[model samples]
Target: MSFSITLVIIIITALISWRAFQDNDLKYKMMFYPYNVKHHKEGYRFLSYMVVHADLMHLFFNMFVLYNFGQVMEYMLDFKYGSSLGTFHYLILYIAGGLFATLWPMSKNADNPNYLSLGASGAVSSVFFAYILWNPGATLNLIILPFWDIPAWLLGIAYLAYEYFMAKKGTSNIGHDAHFGGAVFGILYVLLINFEKGQAFISYIFN
Candidate 1:
């Protein structure tokens, strides 16, 4: 979970996305090969696609948020099982969230030729979700309303609501579906881990 490595990934993604934006013929495709749905094609695109961002702004925002949340997650994960496990878990969650994010877009726009998505927002959201699960009652300071305090879970809920609202509105360029899908997957992932270990904290929260 090196911030430098994360930054490098963002830089690479921005380059690819810029190249694609310049040349339509070179537009990057994810799990769906040739960007076609009927092909039913699947591979490591999920892991690779997270390395592509739509633009500089997109890359900046995603990586900024990721670094902000990731530092804590990386440290805790590392402390839990050394630095290697932290890296491994982070990679898995990032890839899994990206794959799930791609699924929603591909399913809804199965026949869309004008739809091409690229960003690490989904993967970042996964990190945010994981952080919340790990630090359930952590204090979250608000940026806009500086005086008000917010809980991590409430912040997540607010994010989900905003994404769902924007998705329904359908006017934003942001990938709201990806955000929702990633958040959902992240929460479920935490629950699954808890279930496997018979953790009481999860039962208290869900119950």
Candidate 2:
């Protein structure tokens, strides 16, 4: 059997990101520098940024989460809708989430030539939340803090809240806007694909 789409994505991203770490020019080309979009018109940076990460840990964390959530979501999609459409939809949801998330930062930071953001956090968040849409009761425990078992929906709410607050503060270097945008885009994608699933999600929590 062919390797799953999730694994393929992870492998490609890892290889490029590792090389990007060593090549300054590659990293500069991959980074989402608003200056490039605003003036020089290097719009490809929007999607290229997703494949390059800041460091080993950053790549590992994002790819690990993508592996966990993306595999399951793709499996569900393939099972529910047939193989071809499933793979295509999975591809769309991921790349679209990343592509869609880029617009906001580009528009907001068009004038700030110094502003640069790079990482797959936004795309990873989309995959993470897409899985949550199906299994809201799912819970996660950080490896370092196994005692803290948090429900997915609660964590999702907390995540959005934190991102929103941080985006407003604009103090941290973190791309909270991208995080939030990816998350919302994921949820919306799931809803668009299957509205009944969302209704069930709402009913599952409240009832």
TM-score top scorer: 2
Return the TM-score for candidate 2, rounded to 2 decimals.
0.96
User: What clash pairs does model 1 have?
Assistant: none
Candidate 1 similarity to native, TM-score:
0.78
Candidate 2 colliding pairs: none
Model 2, 1-207: lDDT tens digits are 155999999999999999999998899889988887879999898899999998999999999899988998999889888889899889988998897777778778998988898988998888788888878888888788889988888889899999989987889998898898899889999999988889988998998
Which regions of candidate 1 deviate over 4 angstroms? 1-48, 195-207
Best by lDDT: 2
Model 1 Cα lDDT, one tens digit per residue, 52-118:
6666677678887887887667677677766787667766676787778777877777667666566
- What is the model-wide C-alpha lDDT for candidate 2? 0.88
All candidates' lDDT scores?
A: 0.69, 0.88
How many clashes in each structure?
0, 0
- TM-scores of the models, in the given order? 0.78, 0.96
Residue runs of model 2 more than 4 Å from their true location after superposition? none
